[model samples]
Target: MASMDVSLKEMMAIDGAVGAVVVDYNSGMALGSLGGSKDLDLQIAAAGNTEVVKAKLRTMESLGLKDTIEDILITLNTQYHIIRPLTGRSGKGLFLYLALDRARGNLALARHNMRIIEEKLEV
Candidate 1:
């Protein structure tokens, strides 16, 4: 099993990745963060993304969906924001947030890498 530190470091290796954070969306708090830009504070980003996660959860509940969220993606002009929820027991109630430059990111690969990271992460 990979420790949380190792998993996060692996996340930073993804091409175009600028920052990554493990967050508790339920609490709007970051468990850890790496490589954030001065223009974007990781703390503020984590807090705001909590609303996105909550809204989707509310919608899913209303729809009576039984499945869990694997990940969520938000595309912007210059960046792609990926939020991946951990399915492993050790990572319960937590998610990984990754920021990648759109020009350099391979979305499919990034998603696959995130799945791998989530699988190995020990929380």
Candidate 2:
């Protein structure tokens, strides 16, 4: 298993990664972060994405769907934002957030890597 810091560092190694963070959705707080800049404040992104996750969960409940979310992807002109909620017992309220430069990123590989990272993360 990998520590949070190591996992986050691995996330940054992805091609085109601009930032990565491990966030606690229940409190909208980031437990760890790497590679963010003035243009991309990971703390602010964590808070905003917490709302996104909450809303999706609520929507799923309201619709009576018993499915779990694999990941949430938001595409912009210049970037791709990926939110992956951790499913392990120790990681119940946490998620991994990754921002990538659109032109340089490989979405398929990034998603694949995120899944692997999630599986190995120690929380």
The top-ranked prediction according to TM-score is: 2
TM-score of 2: 0.99
In angstroms, the error of model 1 at 42 is 0.9
Model 1 accuracy (lDDT, Cα): 0.90
Give all candidate RMSDs, comma-separated: 0.8, 0.5
lDDT of each: 0.90, 0.97
lDDT, candidate 1, 1-123, per-residue tens: 888788889999999898899999889999998888887688988988889988999999999999899899999999999999888887888899999989998989999999999988887
Off by over 4 Å in 1: none
Model 2 worst lDDT window (10 residues):
34-43
| Residue 10 lDDT in candidate 2 | 92
